[model samples]
Target chain A: MSHPTSTTNKTLAHPLNAWYVAGWDYELTRKPLARTIANRPLALFRTEDGRPVALADACWHRLAPLSMGKTLGRDEIQCPYHGITYNSAGRCTSMPAQETINPSATVPSFPIVDRYRFAWVWLGDPEKADPALIPDMHQMSSPEWAGDGETIYAPCNYQLVLDNLMDLTHEEFVHASSIGQEELSASDFKVTHDDRTVTVARWMFDIEAPPFWLKNMRDKFPGFEGRVDRWQIIHFEAPSTIRIDVGVAKAGTGAADGDRSQGVNGYVMNTISPETDKTCHYFWAFMRNYCLDSQLITTQLRNGVHGVFGEDEAMLKAQQEAIDANPDYEFYSLNIDAGGMWVRRLIERMLEAEGRLAATQEPQPARVGA
Target chain B: MAANSSTVWQRGRVVELRDVARDIRRVVIEPESPVRAAPGTHVDIAVVVNGEQDVRSYSVVESDDDGTRLALSVFRTPTSRGGSVFMHGLGEGAEVELTQPLQNFPLRVGAARYIILAGGIGVTAVLGMARVLARLGADYRFVYAGRSREAMAYLDELIDEHGDRIEVHVDAEGTPLDVPSLVGGLGRDTELYMCGPIRLMDAVRRAWQDFGLDLPNLRYETFGNSGWFDPEEFVVRIPRLGLETVVPKDRSMLEALEAAGADPMFDCRKGECGLCEVEVLELTGDIDHRDVFYSQRQQEASAKMCCCVSRVVTPAATGSRERKPVISIELS
Candidate 1:
């Protein structure tokens, strides 16, 4: 391997075989919504019967963007240009001036499933699009947890977001005013990975809780004033999804041994979808097991995480700009990169299986006529 | 450039060495720190040749998951400056200095399809890439070309691993590789990566152009030492610095200049990065543009040369130690 000093990690392509959230369930409805997942433009909408549908945004007739068109009848979209209509399955339903419809007048219909409050779309092989493979975001809809989240249209590669989530040490610096703490940088962590998942577990015992965690702890255990046991267990699912188990409890309550009854536990659910080579749709939620009925806590937690992640968003954007400037610089990994490395290895495997990955990620411009 | 002026070299020791094929030896080294190498990664090793330390680059043929161990295959070329000979002479437990594995030839993940072509010793470059694709169940074709069956290293292993996806073209069989046929068979979406002799690379490039394939889709890594002309003694003079040095047949111009205390900016000594490039002020002989850093048009213009792997050659000199062609250049 020749490490070029000027290489950028932004050129890594996204894997398409996995399902990515196209939009929140509420975001897709009678009116068609335009979205790009894994570089494939799509028109997302719901049929009159309330079934989620995703179709290639381009119309079959003149390649017009169907997303600009209006919904009509039961489950069809009328192309804004030339009155072409396509059903939810992307089959041309009717032609304005022609009697016989060309059998080939059909757009690609992606397999879309509505689950966990999201419209998940698969842009790769339709046959392999299995809903079971969707990452486990049960916390989003489960009765045991209550929370809210917002979407961040991050202006950086999806992998960068995943790396941010996989390693929490960055929080110490990037979110110094909120969740950042010296214990985070001083603590040792463990990283483990399998074929489809990676887990990074870190624990800080008998340490002062960070401001964000302190507020959450007070919400559960009022007037708590002693050292606490804090933990951040990052779980990564292949392609791009991460669920971070986080919270703090009283120092000597046996929380480390799975008795979380003395702790305030929260799940930071994140799933990123690449919209292009350098941008992504970051969908994240902060679910808490202790406050299952309080709407106030849900909004407050969402707003707090939002602010913490805003810091990350700024850093990610700056990192991306630096990468763009030095297009040939390669990244140097530290000891903390174990979990992120596994994530990249898994992604590289998926890309290789799709025959889209080379051993080296050299950013070659799209050649003319290619 | 100043940040990269100083390189950090770590101590390593040879753990094992064995002949894998004709003139090809596989040497395994354990560096002080664990090394994880991606496919198409190579390392720069400081080899002591004739009591003087010189740097040489070699691709990592394989590595364990933990990266504590790495294996590199070297072909002993009688004309090689010194890297291969020094490596061939090393015994188990021999101490050496090497840089961390670096990747200049990374395989971009996520293409529609791929065709991996390797020629003779060039197999060392793409072997890891082939294994990765095979492990991932990617849609790919592996083509290996060699002068004879015995000369092809890891032939049996590749055939066993890739099964029918492996295609071998042994020149001894009197049926050489057909570049046009190969290029014609490629799908428009297929990316082809090749590493081989200069003749083979030239044929492939010509065929790719004739077929009107995508230029960027045809990626390749060239041997820095294999040029249009054989190695010969050359004289390099920098008028601005009042420096003149003789680059012997066994030494590269970059190394010779550095030995003479001429500070030059260089990275990826394999002629991939144009950093070590110098402006051709004057030439008393023809320049062999061996580096892949320049385009064919740039090489033909005769305005510069990558001193790391390129040199000046006299038209009438062949195996003549007395012939020293002088080339005046300005460090860029």
Candidate 2:
């Protein structure tokens, strides 16, 4: 195994102004919850009115983690070490031993908005916190859809997870027994990109259904076994949100031509937030539009997805260790890395723009619309 | 006499205009100066229509904390009487006069919980309330009902920002919202705030009353254009002014009176204000009292009506040859 220092030096820096899924919304309640984003410790909690707020975990006075402190009243957080209280905006409101709060007694507060059952925090300029920039995860919230998911902490860089999601050919090798099928590996795929999004789509026609799909679809369609058309459409938003729409239908059902109802459709929402250079927070939700009220299907799909992602996590962590051991080795890109590469390019462009703007010391142009 | 001091007129530039939903355009205005806007507040904007300054009130959908910019989602209804048409016609960079943010439906803080009921374009009014509640960490449920998801303004953004706290009911999806069940399911201490079409508000109000909920807990704002009775041609007799005019189905009594050169005192044409109230001398029909300004007792008395929105609906007499529901009223 390589020394820890070798891995520490290889940690990647993420863009500061982009939104990152900090954690599930239900995780941050009355109690102060602590999480790390881009290597910065953050404390998340709700005020008296139930609004979620995110602030730097460190107290400005004694450098104690605010998450260790108890929330006072509805909007104030009292440092556990010194009993100093800070308001929801991170301004020091009171000190037990001081008559007045110091002029510089404040902590950085990040803009947070709850969406798709996740609290997204903007770690950049508050003025630039445009809620519209948040990726549209409508399937998770719409009543037309239903599913369950679990958040797993992976001891690997988020980029590795992105690569894993962008390329599903590994499924045939990694998850052979569950969701994997030979058709996925044999099928050709295409990658497309716009100004802010990248999409990788694959279709396998007249192929046998995978074991997982066959198990889930048997009761819904109990006819004799037959060939089916399968598809996997992966959409990567700027930064770290990926949604994979995968399903299967009877052959020649026109499932690829915007008519998804012809097939059993399901969505895999994978949102990654970098906790540090070597570790990330992985938030995943699996949902389906059909059988929405069926708890059996929900549980079965949840477990299936959880197990599938566990396989990816094991591979990604092992890959990270390998990269750490061979620090001088440069990685080569493959045909399937197009989507992940596009995502990285977009992040680089955003970081470069932010750096240029900072160097010029120019204020962001006033935004007229959301 | 001093000019009307109640309205603090301000100039604003239309910086952005884009469709948020079918027939619903999101108008973003940058005020000449900053203006503070409380939750559930609205602003009155004035526009030129047919060479006349026509003013209409629009709920503030979103605003910066400092109120440097204001966003109003305007829905151009099929029956819009020039105001929404003019607003929809405006392009980016258009300048208009607007009143400072006015709080008619101010959100009551400190409630144990909140229930926001919105219908169609009425989502614009309740949006800020939801934002404030989310920020305060207050417990609230937002229910938005519309004919269809595509026709609902700010549906995507609201769902994105609110998560599961929002419940959307689209009639086209056959998932019509049951207002009674929703109202009855509310906690005893939950406060309800609603804004929408007249019919929806009326239905909710009826359901709320049936549930025997506290009257104080129920709050609502109307667009002033909705009425219980289908609008029909009516004859208005003004004895004091010695003028008679035919109020068309599309026109209000106030508009007809004003067009006939009679200056009638009026404000808030949406029936919330009694400024345009006129004593009914001889009502030859039953009155359709639509304004929120009067109590049930006053409406039952049938002594006066808000000429701006409330109208007379004549009932057919038993065994009468002419069974038409024509409304005829003599104004005092």
**What is the DockQ score of candidate 2, to 2 decimals?**
0.01
Candidate 1: stretches off by over 4 Å: A1-11, A363-370, B1-332
Every candidate's lDDT: 0.84, 0.79
lDDT of 2 by residue, A1-370 (tens): 2211111222345677788998888888879998999888999998877778888999987699999888887577889998988876676767664333443357887778888888898887544566778887888889999998899899998878887888889999999988888888788999999878999999999888888887666746765378788999999997888999988887887887777655688899989999997899999999888887889999989998888888888898999999778655555667776777777667656666566313322222232232
Write out the backbone clash pairs for model 2. A49-B136, A49-B137, A49-B138, A50-B136, A50-B137, A50-B138, A51-B134, A51-B136, A51-B137, B224-B270
Candidate 1 C-alpha error for residue A18, in Å: 0.5
Which window of 10 residues has the lowest lDDT sum in candidate 1 chain A?
A2-11
- Candidate 2, residue B26: Cα displacement in angstroms equals 32
TM-score of chain B of each: 0.71, 0.71
Write the residue-wise lDDT of candidate 1 on B9-73 in tens digits.
79899999989899999999998986677778787899988899888889999988767898999
TM-score of 2: 0.51
Q: Going through the candidates in order, what fraction of the true interface contacts does each contain?
A: 0.00, 0.00
Off by over 4 Å in 2: A1-12, A356-370, B1-332
lDDT of prediction 2:
0.79
| TM per prediction | 0.52, 0.51
